[model samples]
Target: MSLKYIDLFAGAGGLSEGFIRAGFEPIAHVEMNGDACDTLKTRTAFHYLNEKNQIEEYYNYLKGKITRNELWAKIPDNLINAVINTEISAETLPTIFEKIDSVLGKDKVDLVIGGPPCQAYSVAGRARDPKGMTEDPRNHLYKYYVEFLKRYKPKMFVFENVPGILSANNGGYLELIFEAVKEAGYELDKKVLNAKHFDVLQDRKRVIIIGWKKNLKLKYPHFEENEPQYEILKDLFSDLPKIKNGQGEWGAVDYAKETNNYLEKSGIRNGVCFTSQHIARPNNPNDLEIYKIAVNKWVQDNKRLNYAELPERLIKHNNTKSFTNRFQVVNHKGISHTVVAHICADGHYYIHPDIKQNRSITVREAARIQSFPDDYFFEKSRTTAFKQIGNAVPVLMAEGIANKIKEMIK
Candidate 1:
């Protein structure tokens, strides 16, 4: 028997993907974004394709060698229905519950996993709109999460979010969350975890809260006491084929055929030829020159650049001194800075180290930095792809937590 779980606020299924890779059976996933839901459906379908030896056909479709209809013709019909995409809301909760009940029947869920939208509790968001954030309905989204826990009473639950959550609403929000979970008869343990401390190549930090049913008497998970061998950018992406700024898409018929240790170690399945989402955006001439200057300064200034020191021509705006560390040339020798949704706006905060590249990092590079497997595809437009990747918890980080949960259960 396999452990069964449900995911809520499941953006592009990143957390769910990690659990799946850890050998759990995902019972259902709920997200409100249509584009992200589409991504979830296709990725779920791909898993089925893997099981049925139909991945080759899908790859052929990606290669543009076959019509969409031809690709569908060869895939199993059931594989197409592998995971149902439920766009959730207040009114739709009952219907979603009914579907979950019908699917699982009498089998109890082993775990419940998700993080409610965190913008209301993020430090950057609070800084941007301190007044508006206080009244934001998103601040209380955790209530819905608690409601699900009350209904299902899973053996364990994993909640993920930004560390800012600790002090959100001057500590009121965190208190409310703990009070609700305690009332529901669960013991909670949480900590702020850095991705670079767990084999990921980015300096991303997030708070993971784990709850076990009070009767279980399970030991809470502790951070790995030993120092982690943090991966630099090269460890994660040096094997990928290089691309110039504004480079058009380039994927071969059988991509992933030649992969590096990062891909293989990350468990990315082979046979992929061309990279997905590797296309770069055209850089503005001024920004292009700034990238060159930034990378050079980054290397010369001991891997750091001060925005105030740049020449006026390279400075995009006046009075920019306050935005110290505004233009960062990511150190290739060190772990990357955190990837965030702001990357969707522009890569100014995350420029490539190589001046020759002369542009912000591409979606694929961002995904790799987040520890997503090379073969893992981000769907919809490039903007949407960037947003999903930016907002995702690193797959490796999530997997490490899930594996610990699995051990506690056993």
Candidate 2:
């Protein structure tokens, strides 16, 4: 029988993609974002649930209250364009659970994998509330995940999140996760894995909490201590055409020829810094001065730029003006700094090793570094696309975990 799995909080199907590549058959995915749901529908056979209204029995309850035409009207036109569209309302959690139960029945599911939104516990957040102690009510979503695990009783699960959870309230939140899993009748082992140790060219470190139902006797796989012999940014992106920052799309090139020409005229050959309204320099005097001069000059001169012309949806950098100051150049020959969600908006630190342009990383380029295949289509809005890519478990990293799961199941 084929290994079966379900992905919850599946954003852009990154975890799904990893599982698929590792030979698991993905049956269903639950994602709240419409654009991400569209991306999932386009790529896989899995059902995309978008229903946002409460209906006791989705099939029977939604009957005459809204006609087919009326129900269609309720969905956004952009959402209608998605391949496997359905409405999934937050209030309809009980209905969703029923539907999922009906779908799985008594059949065995090999795995249940996901990383719920951890922004509430993220170190990047401004409040710095210790881990596990989230002021945001949304932090309780973990309880829902545990409930799902108990109901499904999958052979294994992989819960991922930021490293802050370890030290958050001095490991209180991490302990809560352990207790919850234990209560659910699973043996859990937690480890912080660096993406660089795998084949990922970026140096991102994330916590992977692996839990196995106690009845299944399985040992955690030991990660190799030796780094891969050959890993570099150029290796990841060599085939694509070299356009200055913000120039190329997958098979579609948005060449800013005039901008390139202007840069050539100005003796600035590296690349044009893609300007963004959302990006502000840190409060530091020197950083502020540099950013102000750069922004003023770029705006005043009408400098040709690659991604600068894109709408606000394509870019959202940290509000701090000194973000650039904190940026440390990655040794091009070595692994890059951790690819974070914010990297999508601010490419200040992710500059090309060979190019001089200071533009943010392109969505495709970032995806490539994250080990997504070239054919994998990302949604149009740049920021959302980047968030999906940055927040994903590296495909290779997921593959490693999946392979281990495969061994235990056999």
Supply every candidate's count of residue pairs whose N, Cα or C atoms clash at under 3 angstroms: 7, 16
Residue 208, model 1: Cα distance from true site in angstroms: 0.3
User: Candidate 2 — worst ten consecutive residues by lDDT sum?
Assistant: 272-281
Residue lDDT tens for model 2, 10-124: 7777777777767787656777777777567544421122234322222221223433344344444433432223333446567657656666667677888887776766766
Where in model 1 is the C-alpha error above 4 Å?
66-89, 225-233, 250-258, 268-274, 318-321
TM-score of every model versus the real structure = 0.92, 0.70
Which residue pairs clash within candidate 1? Answer: 251-274, 254-273, 255-272, 255-273, 255-274, 256-272, 256-273
lDDT of 2 at 203: 75
> Runs in model 2 with CA error above 4 Å?
45-90, 126-133, 231-233, 250-330, 356-358
